[model samples]
Target: MFEGVDLEVPAGGLLVAHGPAGCGRTSLLLALAGRMRLSGGAIRVGGYVLPAAGRRVRATVAVARAAPAVALEGRLRVKEVMAERRLTGAGVTERRIREAFETVGIAPRGSDLVEDLGPLQALLLATALALAERPGALVVDDVDEGLPPDAHGSVWQALDRVRNSGPGPTVLAGCVRTPPPASGLVALSLPRRSLDRLPAETAAAREDTAT
Candidate 1:
């Protein structure tokens, strides 16, 4: 659990929660997304109340989990997924969806089967869908998962490109490890564990400083 944790990200800013596994990074994202309740605290995200006003918040907030949620249905073509989303409820156009794909530097043909994409391409497609939603806030969990160091840099660059564009939403991501120095990301050096242990460690450090 976290205590006295304060986080602030300006509109369209990128907030990266970097920590080891089990450090409550994903939990914090859930809380901010209103999927989980905050025990006691005020939360204002995308102009909606958190924990309490979850449904309302969800409208303007979109979340894309790790590859587990990146399934694109093998039989359907790449653009078909985008079509399905628009048919269901998204008011976004094909051009807009294509633009999202372009923004991430992925160009899957409309007729391409979902199964054809490699792991990274699949991930990019999932991200493109999230961007298509055009939510006020976007949260992506486990960005660094399953990526080697070489590809990690490229992925971060792509994510950053999307994070700093026109009508950009507030972007938040959680990373378990790697990407040694997470520069250009707000809150990049998040601790590896819960803040429950922080106060005592901080106090001891202060005592040593005082001595």
Candidate 2:
């Protein structure tokens, strides 16, 4: 559990929730996406208040790579995954699927199995699926997970492209490692898990000072 965490990212910008393992970054992202409930405090996404308007917030936010709710099955083919999502009412079009692959700089054959994809490729696929929904905001967790230090740059770059893609939805990502500086990048670091119960205002103040 965490509290007093606050942030405001402009449309089309990227916000990285930076922290170490078990620091609640993933939970934070999940809550922001309206997939998890908040025990206290408040969240306002676009013009909608969370919990009170959670259904609308869930409809407005697309979450990828957060697990349980949004995960790509390795046994599925790329095309099969796209087809399933469309059938489930993600509203992703054939044209948008192709554009999402291009947006993330991948060219996977529709026949390729998700299990055969490289780390960055898998991430791109998850991201592509989320983008296909065309939500007002997109949340992705573990931006640098499983990627080598050298390849971290590539992952961030792809996300940057996603941020700039058509309509440019606000992008929020969770990362164990802080990202290098980039245009429109906002890094918000969380305190240690031991401080999880710290007063809300104090946490917000710490965030401001650290950033």
Candidate 3:
């Protein structure tokens, strides 16, 4: 839905993809994380290139809470989710989970269900889960949705911490609007283009087929 968008993010930097809905913000993040294939153009994440080396890229990239692709099921408990990640071969452990929780500054009870978390807490949990994997890059979508404007800073700050964490993973986060500037935080705006008028299902089908 967008065209001619070029990006260059430093390792461990936070790149905010900001735009209105249907402007390809989510698509761009997915593509960068190697979770979605691009119809055109090239992407290079560290030493890996798009599409051709997608498998290698995916091995070191983690996508979290990026709707439809990665999301917490309401019925699952916090500990269950962590266990599932471990089952999937992520290096998830109680200690790593604790580290992630500390970085995100939240500690939901292990017995608590995903739905019980508030908006910010849910986001924080997703972030922690992704970070616990220790991926080379992390992608998060809708970073500022379902919360008050005042609370936006918390999400940004948590992401900043992720960026600053030692040998941090490159972070790609989406938002409806750009937040204030911060060190190593870069903002890229995606304007709605003609292709954005395509129906959602059609876009999804295109992504599915390409990938």
Poorly placed runs, candidate 1 (over 4 Å): 1-4, 66-77, 111-116, 178-184, 188-211
Model 3's lDDT to the true fold? 0.77
Tens digits of lDDT, candidate 2, 44-135: 77777666888977887888788656789999999898898787646678788788888888888889999898888898898988887777
Q: Candidate 1, 22: how far from true, in Å? A: 1.8
Using TM-score as the measure, what is the rank order of every candidate, best first?
A: 3, 2, 1
Candidate scoring better on lDDT of 2 and 3: 3
- Which residue pairs of candidate 1 clash? none
Model 1 TM-score, 2 decimals: 0.77
By summed lDDT, the worst window of 10 consecutive residues in model 3 runs over 202-211
Cα shift from native, residue 14, model 2 (Å): 0.9
| Model 1 lDDT per residue over 63-160, tens place | 76533433357688887887886775356677777887888889888888877776677667777777777766677878877766677777777777
Candidate 1 CA-lDDT value? 0.65
Please state every model's RMSD to the true fold in angstroms.
8.7, 5.0, 6.0
Off by over 4 Å in 2: 195-211
